[model samples]
Target: MLGHEERYDVLKRSLAREARGFTLIELAITLTVMTVLILMVVPSFTGWLNNSKVRSVAEALQNGLRAAQAEAIRRSHQTAFVLTSATPAPNTVASTSGSGSNWYIQVLPVYVGETLDPNPMVQSGSFGNLAPNVKVTASPATASLVCFNSMGRLVANSDATTSTNFGTTCTAPTGNITYDVTLTGATHPLRVLVGLGGQVRMCDTTRVLSTSAPDGCP
Candidate 1:
């Protein structure tokens, strides 16, 4: 019953409604809200990422230390856990460094004339390439090598061989040898503790070690 003009007008209006979209103001407001949300989340995400790196490095170091201790007990020989920047090899001398990013464990020559084991290298690991931003600091600052006796307890050693040599004298830890792993943007730094009794553990640096706070470091 409608005329041609009315039909045309109705069809155009329907098309206009179908083609409607957000205006410039609405689009800009939506983008601004998204930007603010991203800004708010970025710092928290960065902190979490850095903390995860710290934890990974700490756990790796702890596992390495434990492996060294277990090897010493298994072989009934003195084993040296040395932190060095040197690439670990079967019979290469590893130059020790307190904050070394790599760790090497080897059975030490006990006696002056003792024949070095054919394969002295027990285990090796690298955290440098994995988490370069994570910094490791030993408690004594100069203690880079920890030796374990046949009993799997911390011991003093001045062992040296063409294959492996602990650059510094391995001194028994008075209490616990702590390796603190930290990252620049991390809110929670972690510590790897090696006790005199050969106990290795990782703990949070911000808390006190107790029954309720087992994750805390002393």
Candidate 2:
């Protein structure tokens, strides 16, 4: 008794209603796929954020060092990069948040840059911080002191660790970093450590990175 158009409309609506319902298995499969995607994405995002932070901080230090070196050469005067940890003594890079344990680099107040007072030309450069979970444990070489002298070279005054001139990164006490800044919460930092020798080396608190020519920066 229905007209052709009315019947066609009824059939279309019936199909639409049927299509709106999905089986439990199909729904579960879709959810599972989404869960897998989320799991894969979250960790990668986290790692990316951490690595970017570290790299940025490292590059900043390198830039500062390069600037200091260039300034020394330009003025024919020794320019130094004064170094210090953000925290005080017993300042373990581990206990403090990464946002707190970053290093500070600044021109030594002693050298004047066309200025009268020591600090007139001085400006402090800062790095954002380690992963809040990461910490730096000083060995013996980098404990009490870290400085880039006027000769545009590194100076280590830590009583604990010592460094040697092996033509590269710290090799022994003559080369080892007294303070080992390792990642605390995780297992990665132990694989690498930085020293005050101006050498950004990676090792097991023993063999350090080469501080030779490549060290013109950090």
Candidate 3:
């Protein structure tokens, strides 16, 4: 029962009320929602980022190794792939053993009637240095050097006893030199597996890449 002028005044008041900014309670509720959304999204994003970085590193390593192998075969020359770590605190083989930290592989051209060096000193141009933050601690293997002949065939690694304890170094098959990777803070840590055929494969602990049963690495 309002006149046109009275209706106009009422509508003006409603417009002013509607134009008011959010209240503290509304702001608090909105902030809570936004925080919840962020909390839910951040972990997934972080995991994805970490996983991508790990995969990239693994691929880079695998490609470098495979290329080195291929280059050796194509040119029929001695080629070596050196792995180094950023910080080496002298991982000891045993308390009494001396200088058990650095390790590497040397590709020696085998000649008839010539003796290949059985134990080449790591520092005697046997293995090269590793990349930044990349460390070759150890694995399940009998030797440190896995060599490939000029035909890209894995040289049958020497017969020796290797340590299987955690952080113990192991050599890849003589045919193809491969290495695995472990990322620091990834949600689903990725493992890189290299084949004697110089093919790089990847899988998580939860899944299998190869059709064959579980093994340390192919």
Candidate 4:
């Protein structure tokens, strides 16, 4: 029903409304809300990222150890899981007890003279350097070499033929015994337990250590 002049006025008002943008105060409020939301989320995200990195390293080591055990059983040969050190001491046995970023599960042939084969099988292989901020810590009494016998039994430095360079820290306990390898992050630590029965288990250190928590370390 509008005439030409009236239609022109209505179009101008519509365009003017369409051209309007958020005011300075509205933009400031929106920015403030977004900043607060980001601040609240960033810390939790950082913590989750750090925990994930540590867990990844722990799980990798666990899988490597299990694979080594399986290989020893299948091939009926000895396989060793050795911790790689950055600065290995001369004429001293390798000790997994110290902190390091890398480790290996090496499959070697049977012992001949005074030592097992120096070369490891290519199939078993070595596994990596942990996350930048993560670290590995083994039990104070941990042996550098964890080996499996022909029957897939866990043995640590039991053979006299092994090179003295492999540190002699652990003596097989009379009963069921376990050694711990821990992966530590900024907030939590995870433990990989290797038992004399050739069992490897991953445990969460952050979980409550009670019967109520089924996942608590044994």
Per-residue accuracy of model 1 over 1-218 as CA lDDT, tens digit each: 99999999999999999899999999999999999999999999999988888988988898888888899999999998888877888767778887888998888878766886678787899996755578898887655888899898989886553334755678767888889899888899998988888888899988999999989988
Alpha carbon deviation, residue 120, candidate 3 (Å): 17
Q: For each candidate, what TM-score against the reference?
A: 0.89, 0.52, 0.57, 0.77
TM-score of 2: 0.52
Model-by-model lDDT, in order?
0.84, 0.42, 0.46, 0.61
lDDT of 1 at 157: 80
Candidate 4 structure quality by residue, lDDT tens digits, 1-218 = 99999999999999999999999999999999999999999988877877777778777777877877887888777776666654343333444534555555555535435344444532332335443356666554444456776677776444434454343423553443333333333466677777668777887766765789766676
Q: Candidate 3 has which clashing residue pairs, if any?
A: 84-130, 138-168, 138-169, 139-168, 154-174, 154-175, 155-174
Model 1 C-alpha RMSD vs. true structure (Å) is: 2.5
Per-residue lDDT of 31 in model 2: 97
Q: Lowest lDDT 10-mer window, candidate 4?
A: 176-185
How many clashes in each candidate? Answer: 0, 30, 7, 6
Sorted by TM-score, highest first, which candidate order results? Answer: 1, 4, 3, 2
Q: For model 1, what is the C-alpha lDDT against the true structure?
A: 0.84
* lDDT over C-alpha atoms for residue 148 of model 1: 91
What's model 4's lDDT at 27? 100
lDDT of 3 by residue, 1-218 (tens): 99999999999999999999999999999999999999999988977876666566555555545655675587574444444322222222221111122333343434423343453212212122322333332232332334455666444432212321113222456443334445466655445454566454555644554666452244
Q: Rank the candidates by lDDT, best first.
A: 1, 4, 3, 2
| Model 3 misplacement above 4 A | 1-15, 86-138, 141-145, 156-178, 197-199, 210-218
Candidate 3 vs. true structure, TM-score: 0.57
